[model samples]
Target: MTTRKIVVSALVSALAGGTQLAQATDVFRLEGFGAISRGMGGTAVAHDVGPAGMMTNPATLSLMPDGDQAMIGLDLVTTDIKVTNKATGESVSSDTHSNNRGPYVAPEAAFTKRIGAWSLGVGAFAQGGLGTEYGNGSFLSRATGGLATGLDNSSRLLVLNIPFAASFQVNDKLTVGGSVDAMWQGLNLDLLLGADQVVSLIGANRATGSLVGVLAGIPGLSGAHFSLTKDKFLASGVDAWGYGGKLGMLYKATQDTTLGASYTLKSQMNDMEGGATLTAVTAGGQIPLTGKIKIQDFQMPSHLDLGISHRLTPQWTVAADVSRVFWKDVMKDIKVAFVADAGGDLNILLPQDYKDQTILSLGAAYALNDSLTLRGGLRFASQALRSSTLFAVIPATPRKHLSAGFTYAFSKQAKLDFAYSHAFKETMDNTSLPNTSAPIEVTHAQNNATLNFRYSF
Candidate 1:
C-alpha cells in the first residue's frame, strides 16, 4: 500500500482502539519498535541509519554523519485481563478486543547531519500512551447473581515531543552529545457504570427490614412496597495539555562498546473541566444529575534510563537497559471540583494515589550475513498498582515480556523490520473492600507485534 494509505488505515484502527480510555491506568510500557530493535544489538553509529536508534538514543542521530534520514513505523498489541472475586471464587476476563485494537502505531521521523565540529538533529515521536476495556459479561455468574451490572471504561494519552540535539567528538575514541526537548501532550478519559443488581439488593433489604419494623412498633411500614430502578452513571470525555523536557548523553569507550543514559522530567498538565451525567430514580421520579467537574492539574512521573551495548564479534552485539518510573508521585488522591448550575461549588470525590514501578530489559542481536539480522529480548515490569488503590474504572495487569525480531537489508539505504512480543500470563487478587466480607481478585496477560520500513539517504 501507498504510505498515505498505510498512515490513514493505521489511524482509523488506532481510534477504534482508543475507545478504551476508561480502562487505562497511570502505569504504561516503554518498549516500542525502535527500542526493541536497539535491544537486539544495533550499534549507535555516528550516522543515522535506523529509526529505532533515534528514539532509543537520540545522540546516535549525530553519529549519522553521512546522510539525512526519515522513517515511519507501526505497532500492534494484544492483551488479556482476568479478575477473580476471591470472596465468591468467580472470575472475570477481557481481551484486546476487535482484531487486537489494543496496539498503537508510533510514527517517527528525524533529520540529522554533521557540521565542521558538531552534529545536530531534531525528531518527533510518542512518549507514552495506553488503552483498555472490560465488559460486564466477563464477570462470573455467581458474582453477578443475574444482575445486569457491568462497567465500560476507556482512555488515551498522546504526546508530541521534539528534541534538538548536538554531539561533539571529544577525543579519538570518545564522543558526547546532549539534547533539549519541547513536548506537548493530550489526554482523554471516559467511564460508565451499571448498578441494576445493587439496586435490587437495596430494594430487597428495604422490604424485609420494613416488615420486621412494622411487627414491632411501626404498623405503616409493613404496607409500604419497596421498589428500585436501575441507574447509569457516566463520566464523558475529558482532555488536558502539558509540557516537559529531556536530557541525554552517550559515551564510546572503544570501537565496540557504548554506554548511554537519559532523564525525562515529568510534565505538569492543565486542570481538566468536563460535564458528568448521572441518571437514577429519586423520590418516585427519574432524576438526571448534570454537573461539571474540575480535575486538578496532575503531573506525570519522571523517568530515568541507563543502558550499555557491546559488540562481541564482527556480527554479534548485545545490550541491556534499566528504567525507573516514579509512580508514587501519581499516587495522590484525585480531587474533582463540582460546579452546580446555580453557581455553587463543591468537592465531589477524594483524590486517588498510585504505586511506583520499575522495568528491566535485556536483548541480543546476530547478523547472519551482510543482509540479514536477528534480535531477541526479555523485559519484566513491576505490578500495576497496589490492590488497595485499584478501582473498577481502571484495570491493568503487571507484565513480563519476551520478544523476537528480524531485519532484512534490501540495500545499504533501506531495510524491512518485523518484531513480535508475548507478555507472560499473570494474575492479581484483591480482597480489600470497605465493609465487604468478600475480596475481589483480577488477573491479566498481554502481547504485541510490529512491522517497520526504514530508509536512509
Candidate 2:
C-alpha cells in the first residue's frame, strides 16, 4: 500500500474508534430559549415576569396579577454548519443542513394572587425542545480507492417544565420567591453505519484478491481463492424521565433597581431501558445478536445565575446576567453491555468528566414610543461538551453572539416580538482516541437565527 492509502486507512480507523468511545455515553447540552424577545434576552425573564417566564424562572410569576394571563408564541430558526479536514485535501461541503425548523407553538398560562404580604402563583409551560436533522448519501459515502461507504445518524429531544412558586414581600423594597419544578424529558436516537458492498470488498481483498493475481499465478497458489466476508449492523433506542427544582430571590434594592439570583439543582433519571440489535454476516447466513441496556443513572448539571436589571428611565431599561454550569458534578463514566449471542458480553464505556462552562450576557431595551420597543444584546458562552465526546449525530458549535430584536404592542392585551442572533465562529480539535497515537481532527463552523411572536391576556 502507498503512504497515502496507509494514512487514509489509519484516519478512518481512528475516527471509528473515537466514535465508539462517544457512543458509550450520551451528553446533551441544548437549552431551549423562549420565543419571546425578553425571554430570549436574559435567562428567559426570571420565569414569571412575562407569559413565557415560567419556563425557566418560575418565581417571576409573582410579578403577575390575579387575572389569568395566557401567551402563545412561535419561533423560526435557521442554522448553517460546515465540516472539513485540514490534513487531507478531501472536502465535503453543503448548505443543505441550513433550514427552518419551527413555528412549533410555545404556549404558557399563569394565575397569580396576593394574600397578605405574599403572592402565590401557579403556571404550566413548554420550557423548550430540540429537533434537528442533516443527512445525504454523497457526504456519507465518500471513500478511498474508489470505494464508497454510507452512514447516517439522527436524534431528537422533548422537554416539559411545570412549576409552582410563592413570593413574600419583605417590607416595601424587597421580595423573595422560590419554585419546585416537575420536569419531563424524552430522547430518541437513530444511527445507521457500514454497508454490505463495502464489507464484500474487505472480504474479497482478504480472501481471493490478495492471492489470485499475477504474483499468485507465478507461485504454487495459482487459481486458488481464499477470502473472508464481513457484514454487521447495529441499532439501539432509549426513553427516560426525571424531576428537579429551582430556588430564586429578587431584591428590589431601590425603586428603579432590582437584583436577582437563582440556582437550579441537578436532576437524575433512573428508570430507563433500551435494546440493541447487532447482526454479523460472514460467508455463512446472518446471525442475530441482541442485548438489553439498563441505564442505571443519568444526571443533568446544576446551574447558577446572577442578574441585575436597572430602569434608567420610565421608557428605558438595561439588564445583564452571568451564569455558570457545574459540569464538574457530572463525573460518572457511562457503562453498557455489548453482548453477542455466542460471544458472551463485553463492556462499553465512556468518560463523563466534562469541563465547567460560563456564560456572560448583556442587553438593553428602549421603548421607541408607546407601542414599539427595540432591543439588542451580546452573549458569550463556553463550550460544554468536549470534542472527544461529540459524534456526527450531535453537531453543536461553541459560540459568541450578537443579537437584536423588537416588540410591538398591537393593543392593550396583545403584542408581537422578533429577534435575530448570529453566533460567531469557533473550532474544536479532538485528539483523544483509543489504541492510537495520532488524532483525527474534525472542524465545524456554525450560524443560527430565530424569530418569534408573543401575545398576552
Candidate achieving the largest TM-score: 1
- The most accurate candidate by lDDT is 1
Clashing residue pairs in candidate 2 are 47-53, 47-54, 47-57, 48-60, 48-61, 207-226, 207-227
lDDT of 2 at 65: 56
Which runs in model 1 stand beyond 4 Å of their true positions?
1-26, 33-49, 52-56, 95-106, 109-117, 136-151, 156-168, 178-236, 278-286, 340-353, 434-438
lDDT of 2 by residue, 106-133 (tens): 3334444567766665554444433334
> Using Cα atoms with residue i matched to residue i, what is each candidate's TM-score against the true structure?
0.73, 0.70
C-alpha local distance difference test of each model: 0.52, 0.48
lDDT of 1 by residue, 232-318 (tens): 111123445566655666687788878777666776667765565333322233334456656666566777777777889988878
- Deviation (Å) of 323 in candidate 1: 2.1
The 10-residue segment with the lowest total lDDT in model 2: 18-27
